[model samples]
Target: MRFATYEHRDQHHVAVVDEDGTLRPLSGVHSLTGLLTEAGSVPELLDAATRMLDAQPGPHVSEVRLLPPLQPPTVRDFVTFEEHVEGVRRSVDGAAGVPERWYAAPTFYFTNPYAMHGPHDDIPMPPGSSVLDFELEVAAVVGRAGRDLTPRQARDHIVGYTVFNDWTARDLQSAEMRVGLGPCKGKDTATTLGPYLVTADELEKYRDKDGFLRLGLTASVNGEVVGEDLLSNMSWTFEEMVAYASRGTVVRPGDVLGSGTCGNGGCLAELWGVRGRQDPAPLKPGDTVTLSVEGIGSVSNTVVPGADPVPVPIARRRTRERP
Candidate 1:
């Protein structure tokens, strides 16, 4: 079953998305995270959502404001695509190939969960940034808590999938990473999730023999297709990424695991790597970016001008005496 969180008549609701794209509100449920935690399991949640759908559909998808499916407790983005790594290395790192350590295991980085945006929300240009960009990927929402889980065990913990756009500030990211500390301010601006959350069972038909989901992923900027790739191209599957994430830590319900950027042209930074810096220009105010995942859904966000940067003092070095 598909589920959505939307706003109508100034009220927020958690609803079951019907086959025709109409919404059927889950009685008394206003938060997707609350519902997920309350149900404790996907089967139970599905049962409850189904029971609530017996009522008349409330509104058509076009009539309401779509929201980020859930407010995740934590967000971990994994770089699972070898091609994306290869391209970025050549472009940003000025290297020819991927590092061997990348093949050792799935790797990820945490981003600001508080900065999430909904499917159709307006994303402002982050302060002091001129190179605004978008990343096309999918994300898995944890339904049950688990720790030290293996790949197989992790599979059952994921309840649903949603389209994720990991917005970036290219110049800021490049500068900060040179100091070996960040992608911090660069990525803290916005992370888009939604349109709708498709249940794991709903995507079963797309699974390949190797257990990878062979779903087509695409990204467009102002209606022009900028990047396209198959989700199956990732070197490591979501299960592996999730398993690696839980190695020594707990992954709780409502936590989100992003599939990072896809290959080919999953993000503008990757495009800059393949083409030149100015080929496909960085996003500016009034640009609309739409990212779509085959089985899940599409999230389209409009870029808007942000407030002027508030200046801060530059770091000053201090002299130290030998102890």
Candidate 2:
């Protein structure tokens, strides 16, 4: 079943997309806040929520604002795509030596929840970011909380999946990460999520016989395809990521774990290499980027140039000491 949060007639409400493409509101079915109140215990809330949709049905597909499916207690994103890593490595000078361990273990970062935006939302370009880019990823929503869970156990903790666009400012990232501050200013700008949340059951069929998710992912700018790939290309699995994240820490339900950019699947650097050094195409103002993951949904966002002034380096005057 497809679930979404939208605003109709001045009030924001949760609704289920019906078979006929209409938005059927789920009244008294609990707001996003109330739904998240019971995260992590593997509560019957999602089942109950799905039943509510069955009760009041609407169209199959209609125009509506798709908000982030859940209010995550925490949001963490992982870098599990070797192609993206290699592409980034090739971009930077003397960074070609990627540790072999990076290919084995799932690495992740906690992102700011405040930066999340809904589908069809406008992503404001950061100031001085002439090189804005988009990343296509599949984010898993945690359904149960536990510590030190094994990889097998981690699979049971997932409730659903959604398409995620990790918007980026390449120039800012390059400068900030040099200080080893963990992608502060470069990554804190905005992240696009949703269109709809597809339950784990719905996605089960998409999993291949090899036990890997086989969702097709694609990203386009202004209707022109920029990046395309499959979820199966990921070097690390979501279960591994969850198990790693849950190590010695409680991973509550609704917590979002992003599967970083797909292999050659998103971003110009991965698709066409980096600027100047490689003649890659970077995003500019007035470009619309859309990230679509099959079986989940698609999120479309427009990018505009930052209107703020660029920071200027201060010139220091040397004072002569009296002899």
Choose the strongest candidate by lDDT.
1
Q: What is the lDDT for 263 in model 1? A: 92
User: Model 1 segments beyond 4 Å from truth?
Assistant: 321-323
Model 2 segments more than 4 A misplaced: 36-46, 54-61, 92-94, 272-280, 307-323
Model 1 Cα lDDT, one tens digit per residue, 1-323: 88999999999989998889999988888789888887756788898787766466799999999999899989999999998888776767677788999999888899999998999999999999998999999998888888999999999888889999999988888888999875889899899999888889999899999989999999999999989999999888888888888999999888999998999899888878877565589999999999989988899999999988899899888787687
Q: Residues 146-227, candidate 2: write the lDDT tens digits.
A: 7899989998887778888888878888887787757776677788879876778888888876667999998888898867
Q: Give, for candidate 1, the lowest lDDT window spanning 10 residues.
A: 48-57
Q: Give the TM-score of candidate 2.
A: 0.88
Q: Give TM per candidate.
A: 0.97, 0.88
- Candidate 2 lDDT at 267 equals 75
